[model samples]
Target: MTRAKSGKSGKSGKSSRKSSISEKPSITADSSTAAKPSITSKSSSDKPWPYAAGYDNTPEVLEPAPLTVKGTIPPWLEGALYRSGPGYEIQKGGRVSYRSRYTSNDLRERYKKAEAITGVTFCQRDPCKTAFQKFFTTFKMAAFGGPKMGGTDTNVAVIPTINFPGLMDDPDYKKKKGKAGPRNLVMTTDGNALQELDPITLEPLRLFSYGAIDDSLNASNLAPAHPCVDPDTNEYFTVLLTFGPTALYKVVRIRQSIKGPEYEPDLDVLAEITSPRPTYMHSFCMTKRYVVVCHWQCDFAASGVSVLWYGNAWESFKSHDPNVKASFYVVDRHQGRHVATFEADPYYAFHTINSFDDDGDIVLDIAAYKDHTVIGDYYIENLRNETGGKPPQQAMLRRYRLRNIAEQAALSYGKKGQPQPVPAQIDFQLDESVNFELPSINPSRYLRNYRYAYGVNRSGMNKTLIYDRIIKVDLDKIKSGAKHSSSATFWMEDQCTPSEPVFVPTPNSTEEDDGVLLSIVLDGRRRTGFMLILDAKTMKEIARAEMPEGTVAPHNFHGVYVPNSVAA
Candidate 1:
């Protein structure tokens, strides 16, 4: 086993900027290197931005190596902050460390022989180049039950076993029933397969499907990368899209405990939604009473059956239709039925911030885009381009209110062959200039009314690289009034791009912003990574935990912070 020796922490100089929130600080150099840290505002040069380093495949750090702590780590903060874009940082007893192992070793090897791979991936093209070759390969794979979905690259989001005793046998189930976060970490992608990992060592334990949880359901190809969890109920919710003669979207729910024997199938099919043309859904929203499943304008060609012919998800999507408005299917959680279907202007979104029941109305907040251009912009080749290829189209924080949902359902649903789509009111829209994505909020306020939201600002990053700063937005302030300058606060460093800022609340804190934001920042100049700790309220740097020597924590997507008791 490899062990990391404790190294001395370094301090950084405070920014001379007036506002505390948007300060650009510089890190002090360690004795090992004499390089001075500086910030860059322009990217006119033709050189490839170091930010592209994030796209490169990173080696696994399976051992728990101690990280060099630069400042005070909160005494109460202890546990594993599991990042599902493939890594995790464990902070306990004032010492910080990490272990990373993406469950795609086999997939990476296949990419080496790219043309030899058989699976259909989101952005990757089919190995069969020509028309005849594609037809032959797709026919063979679909006929022989070969891989169809984006298999085993479970690097999008990390879901913890918050509920579902059948998923894992926890000895202290009663004590931590609804009070804790995830006990066992599960890695998920935009596919059907779920990868289970040993929480401590980050080792791939087993590969299974939704069928494993319930025998009635077939392991569908398409599923939501981000599953919704009711923090209050401790129940988990996920939608499985099974494509066949008739495409069916089954919203499954798993509760805290099963009534029958241990490990017996515990999945409850909450609602089976039938759609002739199903749009691709990356994430969904869940409130106390309803689950909001929004299908954007990015519909699959031939009702998703063409995926077998094209053998590529992105290729299978029909061109965006401006006339087709995005639809939101509201499922009644308690009654296990579809309550109403609401429609908004055509848009695409990869992540939904939160949803809640406001009296009779179901309010939903999401990071939405105008079209599906954002999907192809993330191709590895474009990101690593010397001149920073095509600039990424940003997502605006949009709010859709399904007003008087019960009344709309009564008037429209079940009245005809297919119910007319109810118009969802556009309550609020964040400024078009502010580009936000990979949103995170206080988990406690997930299914309730919340004020603050943290995410990476990709506004002008195309010229430089990926996301260069972390942003905090006041949702209530935006709804009450509108000002891009006053409503949002940002924390940034020169040439240092941060990942998704995850808000970790202080224990027993009443204030929603009374917590710290944790993000893995890639310092482009030094070619290294560090765990950035920011004061959530003031948006100031609380501390920095530097990773082991030679380790660069590559850019990642969604992550979850597990408290000590549950993580252990």
Candidate 2:
């Protein structure tokens, strides 16, 4: 978590899964002919992209619909043939680079233009690109490490701390060669590291991957449940891991001999909680006695479905009985185990979780749906198979309280040893007629210390959204959020193009007054990513710092603005 002020920067945010568990050949091209490669036409040695489809098959046959999805994409929405979907969809589909061939070529070309204008920025954005690096935000985090999933050999394997969107080749680059796009996992010891392993055996083919980590730290395993750091001692602990649909709610803990480089644990499970439904968590929270979870329902074009999750209400998201609808839950730890539970089904789902300010309240964002049909696929089918569920009818942002969650829990399940969850006593007593609105939701304090919280919602061109805004109870303001929605009211606020905000020390400033909320925004233009500063109190924009073009947006995960403490 070191900061490289002006030149390049650091702070690692990571997530991953065992996609190949073995390295697939980087490209089908011959070594000598590797100099000039084209993504436009499929090659004999080139493997087709997954989002592009049928990776194991020849690229030609898959070509028929790579750019034209008649039935899948609507006629008006046909623009999707080449356009990207919401940020969450891109993350779920594991899309690091824009859609392959088209992206490869476009990126390279864009790089040249940005270079002529901004110079070197992201990874290799050119010298003048310094303004956009947001030197404070570059500290990239990596999930666990281990052998490559496909290609190379049949046996040799080695783990390398995986960094999502690793070493980006400026989005402006023109015609990027295969195996040469944004996103990657490299060796922790050196920047330019690789794992050329044997495909047959999950073993490394070289010595570059000696000191790597593994699946335990895998980010994609579930929510980026922010790791815990002891404020009194600067010691960092990785926690709140997810196993498919279940949240490993405070299951286990990791300890070490020293503070930084001297010790790196092989991530141990600290706590565990099962999601009732097959879910993928995005953000979660931890109280002294409970772990709050948010559910994820991404419409990765691959699956064509959207989702809504309430806390870690896993079982609720699933239509286990066909009579089920979406609901939220709270897992309570009275002594040392998951002692109690409660839930609510107001037909809503969650995407992010956080602490009210940095003091007490448990806060989260919920999405409301219109004419929603739920398709629940529990696992990843082959590329050719469309196993993903259907998305919600439409999504609207909502708000809720975590502290009040206890009463909700009391009314959600039966006693400790009960078989099926039953309505608790409290749920029957509360009046369901009043509407609650949040006045102003402040995330700067908690966000200042916690690097990855869904601080604001995005709503403008569309309806109302929380992705780009900060909402509170008593202040109704989602795009379509109404004062009479029968839910919590959220105060609408705006942030630059940044999501997943992190805290950093002031530029050239000392550590004592550090905790600043920092978010990077890629203007969706030819320029580099921009930095948006926010006040921790009101959760309002304080400044919109400009960075040069050709910069990179954070990959689809959370990041830490670690100061150059002992974390190196």
Candidate 3:
């Protein structure tokens, strides 16, 4: 980690232009020969600008530089805020290939069979190129244009630039069959690996697997994009989804510590739970004592089968089954045991807000959707007004209260001595009117009963999928059925979009909402980006960190704020 002293001081509400730093070479890849769909901006002046189209054209790598500040950065505010997402876009006719030096004969045979099934040839001349070529070929064929591939009309076949560092040199690399190697960064929807960037510069550093540095940590098949951090212990908790004869979910805890001069984090597997089917889960919930994994009816096997045949993971999804019930797998954080499996009404959720124990019952709040249409609706092409398609199903703020969590776990045995599922009641439409996603809360309130939840809401006459407003919800009042329970909303300029809001608590703050909400806002009309800082309490703009002219920050899904002490 690198540290630099703060520059000359500037007053609040005034723009300050800092001297630019010397440019450093950026890590970037160019593959424009692949078959990707072209995006053209709409010509009509009456319509809102197509922001999603530009999403795929942003720069792949950014250099470390000073950003212009519109207002004074809180003098006490000291930390590196990190954001992660797909920085590079696979444009039309863009070709990308990957190779691994440690490929085995068995993998070669499997690749041959997969190629035969999809009629796509893998680069056999270079074993190092085979894995990525096969992966990208399947991805493009399934997502771009192919018979039997659904949603090909949307043209949303963008591949995240996933970089794996130092795997080729590992002597044991070939021994790990079908296991994802250690990566410095993985920016995909499936969460195979994580990428660490310079917290201050947001420059690509390297890719790493979940347990890259810890030998005691068990390898995970897939990693979650959103990992919850415990405010008290500063330990990060996330789930790793694995599949074989049966699907298994493991909850892992990661903690950072100083080893001499470098920061080394240790990883530990907290608990592993079984799922009957392979489910596509994007996020999970963590409480003080339990880690909750929700298995929706949305199964990955339904799509994985197609990848086996057609070579695309996105092509494997089946329609949502209303009759199928969603299952909640709760694991005891301390004992690392499966405490209970509770069932609730069928629904699909991409993100979870918070979960905690309320009088022996587990309460989980999520952005619940009617079905899986939201998955396809996120395609950049699908958000165009010319598509004339109905808006994707909005995820309503829903809460599920599982009664007798401990009691059900104790009496889980059935009459036949088999474990039976527990029942839970769910409450939907707590506010009825507010529909949003990408939720966040103050880090200190994580794993505890939180009062306020912040998230992004979309609005405009065009009704596109762009996020136009940031909303803060009062959980207590909303649960009480009080009218106008929403605390506040910070609306952006027309056509300007904001990414997910991350809450950074003020130093030694006692109040829950006494923090700052940080988000990267993209001015689509101007084709530029900036960081928007808002007062968590009043939802008012405190400052804005403007990017250099012509620098565009691509849309990001999630971000984290590491305080100065932790960052150093």
| Candidate 1 CA-lDDT value | 0.64
User: Which ten residues in a row are the worst by lDDT in model 1?
Assistant: 17-26
Cα displacement (Å) at residue 550, model 1: 4.0
* TM, every model: 0.82, 0.40, 0.71
The runs of at least 3 residues in candidate 2 whose Cα sits more than 4 Å from the true structure, single-residue gaps closed, are: 1-250, 257-276, 293-322, 325-334, 346-350, 356-454, 461-498, 503-517, 524-528, 534-545, 549-557, 564-568
The lDDT per prediction is: 0.64, 0.28, 0.53
lDDT rank order: 1, 3, 2
Clashing pairs in 1: none
Name the best candidate (by lDDT): 1
Scored by TM-score, the top model is 1
Which scores higher on lDDT, 1 or 2?
A: 1
Q: What is the C-alpha RMSD of each candidate to the true structure, in Å?
A: 10.0, 17.2, 11.7
lDDT score of residue 493 within candidate 3 = 66
lDDT of 2 by residue, 189-223 (tens): 11112333111111232322111233333442222
Q: Write candidate 3's Cα lDDT for 1-568 as tens digits.
A: 1211111111121111111111100101111321223444464675335464334333333323445567655666654443443221111222111111111122233434554323322112221221122222222231222332221111111122222221222223223212232222223324444333222232233333444444332234455545666666656677776655566677777654434212334556776776657676667887787888877766765424443453344446667788888988777777766677888888888788888888898889999888865665654445554556445667778888777777866775333332367787785454434777888898777677888988887764534455777878887776676765343455566667787898888889999999888877777766677778889998888877766555555565565554435421
